[model samples]
Target chain A: MDERLLEILEDIQPEVDFETCTTLIDDHYLDSLSIISLVAELEEEFDITIPTVEIIPDNFNSAEKMWEMITRLSEED
Target chain B: MFSIVTYFSVEALLLLLVTALLYACLPQKLRRWVLLLASYIFFYSISGKLLAYLLFSTLSVHHIGLWLADVQNECAAQTKGLARDERKALNAVYQKKQRKIMGFACFIHIGLLVLLKYTPFFSENINTLLKLAGSSFKLQIPKYLIPIGISFYTLQAVAYLFDVYRKKIPADRNLMRLALFMSFFPQLMEGPICRYSDTAVALYDAPKMRYDNFVLGSQRILFGLMKKLVIADRLNLLIQNVYAEPNKYDGFIIALSAVGYTFQLYADFSGTMDLVIGAAQMFGITLPENFKRPFFSATISEFWKRWHITLGTWFKDYIFFPVSMSKPMKKLTTQARKKLGNHYGPLIAGAVSLFCVWICNGLWHGAGWNYIFFGMYHFALILGGNIAEPVVIKITQKLHINRASFPYRCIQIARTFILVCFGELFFRAEGLKSGIKMFCKIFTDFTFASLKSGSLFKCGMDRQDYIIIIVSAILLFVIGILQEKGIQIRNSIAKKNIAVQFAVYYALILFIIIFGAYGAGYVPLDPIYAGF
Candidate 1:
């Protein structure tokens, strides 16, 4: 799951080091348009819905945060 | 109707002092009531009978919140012990019901705002259309005594409703808690637009006044006064004259005034926020910061994020994300990504959402073609920038120009500022036609004849006034640079010796007293955002 998520992140923004950098949204690495692409990619890959409420900076700021949210959401589903 | 004119007025200061005193003397539990009553009094003084509008909004929001809470409770009870599939199905049914209720709530709340605020603008446009159609019939345009800060508070109320519906926040059962949040006197006029989860409980708690907070808050308030009195009001003398009659001036004068108007607006609106947030801080409630050195922004999109930040976030959360993430838009995003690749793919859905957000943003400021033009102007710039990004990057790479270099970043900032100033020119013009004429004159009759002849200072601002404005702007720019570097001026000051702190305060007060625009020949721009 982590590898796939990193692959998607790299595919969207090739310049960003998705492993070490955590301020993706905060630093403008992942803007609204990027997030749109990301959410669609994540849902398709993981088969879990990402609601608008969960699209906050904390969830997508890092790969770990995104993984945690995906795992928690999938369990809830 | 009362002596309290604006937050900067002596009368308003007296009201704040008296309220602070009362709040301090009151029991911890009763402190919230004092705040609530003071908020109502403040509203009543400004809007008079229009206070009823605020009361109605508060009560309606309170009731709707409870209703939504009740619906949630019923759903929880019904879904108990159900299997996963059944529970999901039941939740969907309940969600539909909640959506219907949310729709009605918005109708009542947003409906009242539209009817009150936009009726005249809408009717006038309709009448023009009718006249064009060769019809004699006309709609009667009615004037409304719009409650001061209705625009600000209405957004707050709707945000509350949305938060409750999303279950991000449990709907408040306490009326006074919600009321205090909605009508919190400090942020009532021009807001940083506090969220329920962030502010409601803080207002209810009404923490005891601390000495550090008092000093820090007072310092902030004084800084706000410096911005408003020394800069915003002073610039008003030039901006008002130029905007009121753009054709009377050349493009140079018009352009200068546009930049002046932009500064005036920043100082005016952000100054008000400083006062608002500072006042709230004195009571130990930390409202969200609104302005974040917007002039330093590298793009129009970044400018929006930095300036009037709360409003930007509100639209992002409530409008942009929702529209973009809706089922159809989601599907569009998925398909587009495959076809257009990562960058341009989701842009199709994003553009649609951006359009909706901008249109609402334009109308939200006021009902005018110029305001709408301002919105579309920005929309075009942002979308154009996004579309051109790859090409620009490739071109820069080919030219061996490092985008991260200081010179490059400075160029970006400068370009963004010019674009923003142009938008403000349209925003501040008397009408769309006048705005166009003024813009055209900049190119058609471009000359520095006024400066050569020294007539530039003759219109509203004299030589001395110009000198003072330049010095004050330099001061503001230095301060902005420090703030951008993450230096908290107030905290730094607080850590200084008592004498230094006092000197800083006294210097600020003296500056305002010496150069503040008031008394005669100058009308301080009426709280700019208040009209919106």
Candidate 2:
């Protein structure tokens, strides 16, 4: 777990524990636009292009999920 | 002008007969073409010569797009296998040619739009300026009639050029497909602002001629009619009266009228979108969704995101991002941050984007000063929120107050409502001066005691009318709530037993037929967004 990623999560959801908070979409923590904004921020931070089709909730619903998605994208690049 | 008599009594029957005939006679691929033709004829029946302008604009853009694509392909080929200097020279020529073509296309398209929509405003302003200079100049306000779908098609055409430029989609080769994209009759008058990419597939696909599509489309159209006639038009009478003379009303009454206009505009616009999209669906084309439980939005930004989704997206993509991300704007932001510190950069950027969007939005509605003020009013609210967001968050943190607490959320919602009402005051006002007068009257002559005196209903609506408005508004709100919770009303109904489904359908039809503000002494009001 990257400390910078933790810091970003804290900025978005100050009260929630980044490690514990899962199922972001199911919990309704972020709507579609919010998710897009987050993805854009993550792409800028990590220097990776998140494919448009990979932006679905299934791949972005949790910290672990997002990390996995980003890792995959980075690896593909 | 042809004095075409509109017989609402025969409209449904005629539509049904035509729909049936098209379904029975036309082959799969040809039905959509027939529908497209029918749509043009329908628009021509209302707009006459203006329809010819629409056709010309559509055909011109279609041909230009195809030509531009060829030029782009040629440029790509020429750039390949060239030395650096030669490549640069070739690229410059290509760029210059592309720019000329695009500039010419945009000039012609937007020229027609301005001539048709803004001539009166331009003439009046020029005359006023001339008079101020003591010239006493009199200019004839050109009597150019605007086509019914000029604004919509213009936007679509511009979007096509943009799409081609960005290489989001290939320039459409088929003239008929491009024509259908522009003149799809359902969205011709008022739009969800159909995009080339969003609707191209459904528009070009050979029509399936399925019974299911027809039934579903009919049901959707019925739902749209119910929302528009039964709820929106009925509420319009009350809204118009209070807004017409805001001085005679108290703050509460004026506020109520503002709220009423909100509902009326939403229902009228969304209902029309539904009808248009549904009609397109009948021809096996699915137009973009325009509304999605907008009132449930917790923030002003969220409300905009949900309300008029298509138009908002269009503005965001075509106007806001471009202006915000422009080189000059970026340079200014960088300089400002270095001089004024990091805090001011976001604020300045936001203000620039907000101003651009609002000015364009206001002018897009019409040339009236009221519309301009309406645009600025919202611009101020949205910009103010963006500026104050960090300050508010800091204050809450310092006070140890929970930002997402229920009480805080309630306060935010209440403030948003107030801000929205104030903006709507300008939107519904007759002119800029009247908007100011009515706004001042809100505080000067406000009396809450008089609100309960039953004088509010006297504003062109009787007791029964008020009752109907309130009831229908409640119904509208209830349905909106259901939708906000992600309950797909149509799909839910489809999932029900056949008997129950039929019963609900019959009930909806009966409600619309009996309670609708159409037929028998009712003058049908044009869909409000058609003016834009």
Models 1 onward score TM values of 0.98, 0.85
User: What's the distance in Å from true for residue B340, model 1?
Assistant: 0.8
Candidate 2 docking band:
incorrect
- Candidate 2 colliding pairs: none
Q: How well is each residue in B1-532 modelled by candidate 1, as lDDT tens digits?
A: 4645688888778878989999989898999999998899999988898999999999999999989999999999999988878987898899899999999999999999999999999999999999999999999999988999999999999999999998899999899999999999999988989899889999999999899998888888988998999999999889988888877888899889988989999999999989988898899999999999999999899999899999999999999999999889989998998899888999999999999999999989888999999999999999999999989999999999999999999999999999999999998888889899989988887789999999999889999999999999999999999988899989999999999988988888999999999988789779889888
Q: Distance (Å) between predicted and true CA of B290, model 1?
A: 0.7
| Candidate 1: CAPRI quality band | medium
- Which candidate has the top score in lDDT? 1
TM-score of chain A of each: 0.96, 0.85
- Candidate 2 structure quality by residue, lDDT tens digits, B1-532: 2222221224533654586577558776786677677667767776887778888988898888887899989998978887756876786798678879888988899888988889999899999999999996699888777788788889999888877865567998888888888887667777888779888767767466566676677778878887788778787777877777777777777767777777778878888777777777676677889898776666787778788888888887777756655556555654554475444553576578778998888999889889888888778877777667679889999999998887987787777767777777788888888778777877777776655787766776668767777787788788877886788788788778889889988998998877888766565656678778
